[model samples]
Target: MTSRFPTRTSGPSSIASSIRRPAALGAAWAALSTFALSEPSFAQNAQPPVTELPEVTVTTTTTAKKKKAAKAAAPVAASQQAATPAASAPSAGAPAPGSRSGSLSVPTTAEATAEINRTPGAVEVVPGSAYQTSTPATTIKDALDYVPGVFVQPKWGDDSRLSIRGSGLSRNFHLRGVQLFMDGIPINTADGYGDFQEIDPTAYRYIEVFKGGNALRFGANSLGGAINFVMPTGYDSDLFGARIDVGSFGFRKAAVSSGGVSGAVDYFATVTAQETDGFRDHSDGESIRGSMNVGYRLSENVETRFYLNANNVDQRIPGSVTKSVALNSPETAAAGNLLNDYQRNIDTLRIANKTAIRIAPGTLVEVGAFNVDRHLMHPIFQWLDYRYDDYGAFARLSDESRIGGFANRLIAGVNLHNGNTDVRQYVNVRGQKGAQTVDAEDTSRNFSAYFENHFFVTPDVAVVAGTQFLHATRKREVEFGATPGETEFNLWSPKVGVLWDVTRNSQVFANVSRSAEVPSFGESVNVGPTVIPFYDIKAQRATTYEIGTRGANANFTWDLTAYRSEIKNELMCFYSAFGNCNVSNADRTVHQGLELGGGAAIAKGIIANGANPDTLWLHASYTFNDFFFDNDKDFGDNELPGAPRHYLRAELLYKHPSGVYFGPNIEWVPEAYYVDSANTLDTEAYAIWGAKIGFDNGGPITAYIEGRNLSDEAYIASASILDRANANSTLFEPGNGRAIYGGVQVKW
Candidate 1:
């Protein structure tokens, strides 16, 4: 595949090529040595004993009480067994249920971490409580600030570019490549388009991240893998809670939540309202979001849950600016954005249900269904009005058994997703719809089936294999213009891996997998000159190889991974003079990276051992990215734009037994990175420093004050578009300036 646009022939001499083989080897050795030195203390601490934690009732209801009485009168042997304290404890390597104050429908944070560690692929779990205690929960970036290999930068309000392992690097608006889910229900549309506006970080109990093909179990077939946000249920949440936050740039937010359990039923709900007059021109916005769930315990071994989510978002767009302008007058809005009054407004509602049943000992069955409705009103180069209705269903079965003295596990599942969208475009009359230019109806249908098995070669070793078969179709009917089009795609993805336990809490793993992504309708919608049907565009595919190790003990924790992916038919886009993008496919490319995360307690017990607080602690996350196009027809071995080669975030903190803590943090980009595929434009390297002071005791009240960009550095946060950028290229998003924020929370 080749592009018609003019290209600049540049060799592999950019920032990505500066690292020679010797340097790579030296870095690898250094990382290995560091891991070795950090291993001893962690290994000395043993795993905690398995035991049942006490349960505390937070609320009661008459209807729930009657349901519990009816269930008690029924014959339920499985329920009886599950209720037994000794029988309820999870087996070794199994995820544990949440605490009594946690949701009964899902595993606790520690349990999720343990379960993720068992996978022979890259994955991580972040506890929600860690971010909600005393911090600004305004954006997804705030919650994932320390996750390695993930790049998150805000554009306006909740809209942001979220890329995992260089995934979705080219697309400048909305999200692709990465699949998003809430409690196992997909948040993305049936065709794999997603937005960050629907995610409520404060509503989740914990978040799970599966990188690359590790997310096959969830039917995610994309290079970026998937992220699942698990919400807390009534059985595991506080009865009442409230929070208020005020920050720089006219930011204000308030939220309230409640959760409780009564007899066999439980419920949890949260609502938040926020408004901000942003730091940059035409970047103001407001939003209101709510999330709720209710679960019923049919028996000790059977449970069902229902979820509801709603979001109303209105945000202005500042648009990108020239690099020179971004670094000089960072607050200036793009000229076109100001004239057109570009904006994005959306209203979304989602409903989902999931049920789990233990048909027999060590065997389980799960079924789920979801529906989503969304309306989008956007104005930029053109006025866009779109409506989407998406729905899907899934079923899964899993069994764990011992065969010939060896432990084995098998999982099989199927998913069906379908959606219809009404697409319309009109001339922009100062953000108002004018002369209609295009009208169409787009429909998508997707189906997938997968199976996986893990057989223990030894008590501490296992062999794993899995495969998924997918069939998808996209249909577009142009009601007011050119001919209609329909496209069909079929693919088979396979995976194989091995896991070896080095210690009770540590393991090493390796895996090879294949992933595929189909193009969404947005990719095929041509708007500028030379408009042509994109039915011939092919799906992007990649074969990835990965190796990693993860472990945690009382004093330290670490997760490190190295991966390389060879890709074909990569979905790529180039921008026109008017800022409109044309999507196409690249012949060949490579994405390789190293992800490292770790935390250690340098000093402890300064105040009292019984209180168990660290006097000094350090935590860090680092990513090294090397993404480049192979010898393509246009760009020869040039590095892909969007992400930097080396990025790091680190922090050091001091804690007192009295629940007071203070920390300093740094965000650094070590080298300039290209802003266009032609390698003609780049963003300068930068380092920013910040600090925070907070207090938390797992109690009723918590508070925090934070300062960001204390040095008031003017730097580029992100960029977009263009195949060949130059001095006049307007493709830079400026970083925020110095700011301070404070927040408080109360719970009962």
Candidate 2:
């Protein structure tokens, strides 16, 4: 297939108009050094003389009294044991004696990290506490800033583009390819579309990122794998907490939460409100979010839990502008956006339940069900109103035991998801509905079964294998059109890998896997002069080969991976003369990349040593993406449009024993990258500098001040629709200018 898109010739321009002053950098370093040397150490002050504090004395009890007390406590101990089932009990980070090797259980932070290191592919775990202090904590982008192989850039408010290993590079709207989950519950709709507005950064205890086929445990068969956000239960959370944040551009936020346990029941709840008058015109928004969960112990072998989530988001759209306008007049909004006051407003609610039962020693069974309702109101070139009802159910079984003196584990699961969308469109008369233009009903269904096993060849070596079978269907009933359309697809994906323990804290591994993605209803809709039904488009598929190593020690930690994928029938999109999008499939493409991330303590105990030593730390993440067409009929060996070839982020900070710290960071793109599939127009290479200072004593109070884009450089943060070069493309989203923000958090 050939596209009639026009091509153009252009050269890259300088992206950085200015750089940080030498005096500013010098002053920051000097201040950090001075504080590290002069501040009184909290560790020193925490020590006390043996005679300074009061002492308590215990009296010995008689044998007769002890016997009576023991008799009274026996029944209470038995009742406690009955209420806290082994299957639902809090994680202890280890299996019981004589238990099977495949038993499944929730893991604490330390245990989770260890498992991530042992996996045979790229993976990461981000602790929520790492960003809970002295940060804006506004969007998912903030939490994943330092993760390599991931590219996330904000459009306006909380809306952003998230790509993993070049996945979803052609998607200019909501997310695709990557699976999202909240507390093990699917966050994406039945057709695999997800939005960031429903995610609250403060609501998670930690996040697990499974890159590529490593996410087999969750039945995610997409190229980007999955990301799961884990929330804290009442047993692991604070009793009370509150936070307030204020910043540039009329930004303000407040949040409060409570968690507690009583008898056999535990509950956790949080509410947050936020608003911002964005940096550009027609870019203002507000949101309110609520999340809650309750858990009850049923018996010594079973437990159940329930969850609820609600969100109301109202955001104005700041449409993309021309490249020159984006660089020269960064704060200016697109004329169409200002005139029509384009906006995306949503109201959503979700409820879910999950149960766990221990059927036998070292064996567990889990089942869950969820329902979601959402309404959307949007206005741009047309007025759009959509309502969606989505629901799903899932079940999983796990067993861990020794087979013939060899440790082994097995995991199996099944998932079912279904949804229906009522879509309506009308002529836009200054952002108001004029006349009904189109009405349609879209339905989707998905069912999947997956199984994985890990067999230890030796104490230090393991072989892993998994497979998933998926059946999906999409149907669209055009009530206002002449014809309706429907499509069905079935696929089987398989994976195999090996892991070798090179040492106690390090491992080496390799894997090969296959992934497939079925097009959504939006991708099959007909528009413009092309009246051909998009149901003719085939699904995209890829086979990937990967290898990596990861490890952590007392002072240093690192993760690195390299992978290459050969893709067939890759989806590509471009603009038509009417400004509408036309989607098609490319014949062949190749995606390959290298991802690296690590951190180290450069200097320890500059002024003092021992427990609370003052240290200087350095952390860095880098990605090398090489994605292109492989001798295609139309665009032969052209580079992919969105991401750059090389991207790097690094930070250096000085810490004091008294919980004060200061840091400087940088986001650098050292090479210009193409913005069009024609390989004509491109983005300029640039570097940005930022700094932050904060005090966190691991106590009830924490505070911090942060600044970004300190040099006020103008650069493109992201882009829109893929197209051939046109002087009026309007495809650039400008990055925000210099700004400062501060916040405080308290808990008891």
* Winning model by lDDT: 1
Q: Give the runs in model 2 whose Cα sits over 4 Å from its true position.
A: 1-107, 115-118, 481-483, 525-529, 574-580
Q: lDDT for model 1, on a 0 to 1 scale?
A: 0.76
lDDT by residue (tens digit), candidate 2, 264-354: 5667899889988888887888888899888765654566789898887878888888889989998999998877768877778888888
- Top-TM-score structure, candidate number: 1
List all candidate RMSDs to the true structure: 9.2, 12.7
Q: For candidate 1, lDDT tens digit of each residue in 398-470?
A: 7767778677778899999999988888898776678998899889999999998878777667799999988
TM per candidate: 0.89, 0.85
- Checking candidate 2 for backbone clashes, the offending pairs are 100-400, 100-401, 101-400, 101-401, 102-399, 102-400, 102-401, 103-400
Error of 2 at 621 (Å): 1.1
